[model samples]
Target: MTNRIVDHPVLGKLTNRPPVTFTFDGKTYEGMEGDTIASALLANGIRQLRVHEGTGTPRAIYCNIGHCFECRVTVNDAKIVRACMTPIQNEMVIESGKMQPAPFKASPEEWPRTYAEFEKMNDNHKEGVPHA
Candidate 1:
């Protein structure tokens, strides 16, 4: 009942890789040794990896290509890694991000943009809008 395709018309058959055991949200699950955490979760029909930081709505893999940070999850209670980019490993503790009551607040420390730099950036976008 997995969504994973074992055989493809172009790639023929995908060899069965060694089984890897891991836990997601405290529930044990099995995945192929080389599968990414996101793929493993999707194969097992466990979507909704985490909630949106701005809105408490549930979110799954949006771009799967690692460009988007929508699939971020905590690993081993310490590191926050993108599930779509992180490979599955044995006994890895994966936890979904907890829901936030309010939207994430951006700070100068995180962005590090000076007021002058911000003004210059804003000025560049002025041409795109019609003036009153």
Candidate 2:
């Protein structure tokens, strides 16, 4: 698809630069050097990147920034990375669906299975160290 950012309301004619091509789920798309992965996908008319793990529903960018995890996608074998924050690189492979088996499994290093556990851990922490 055409990577040229013609005329956007707020962005307003994205600056022309060296074009780079990459694939999203096997479809080629062109984007500028400075565009984030999300921006490039949006420019190429790709809204939904992956399906939700539990619900299997379509999901895409939510906050447009890294604050929300809705835009998570597998990049070059790395899972759960924020797509909006990642810049497109040459030959990068972006895949849909939550990475199977999870990169982190049954590991205390990946704590807080639920938000409540995260909150509890946060409450017990002092100087960024959890109470032992």
Candidate 3:
């Protein structure tokens, strides 16, 4: 069964658009029109989208909005985009970004102890951001 909400008291019945066929990671799946790629994947019971870069842990959609980029995926064998924000299209090829694992050497003590330190660390780590 699909994990979609077909009806609701507040919203009444859902009139979904026509189903769109697409491929994710070489596997075909059917999603309804006006559905975001992330929502479609979740409806189809796909929880995990990709792996974490540093620890190699699994990652999935978080926050459901475009704010959190945890649901990023490559679209049409080209640009990487936030799945939660991108609409699904027919025959569209979506591939999860398989971030390679990297060694995390820092222990709890070595890690930042405060939010300010964490911000500092992140600011330094991110590239192309103008230093102020």
Candidate 2 local lDDT, 1-132, one digit each (tens): 455457889979756778778888877778778878888888788889778775577899999869978988888889887889999887788877653444333366657889897776667664666568
Off by over 4 Å in 3: 101-132
lDDT of 1: 0.83
Of the candidates shown, which would achieve the greatest lDDT relative to the real structure? Answer: 3
> What's the number of clashes in each of the models?
0, 0, 0
Compared with the true structure, all predictions reach lDDT values of: 0.83, 0.78, 0.84
Number of the candidate with higher TM-score, 2 or 3: 3
Residue-by-residue lDDT tens digits, candidate 3, 1-132:
279888988989999679999999999999999999998998899988877765668989998888988988889877558999999999999998786743334675667878898777777787797877
RMSD of each: 10.7, 9.9, 8.2
True-structure lDDT of candidate 2: 0.78
Model 1, 1-132: lDDT tens per residue?
Answer: 268889999999999899889899999998898899999998888999988765578988999898988899999986568999999999999999877654223453544267886656566658688666
**Backbone clashes counted, model 3:** 0
Task: Provide TM-scores for the models.
Answer: 0.72, 0.66, 0.72
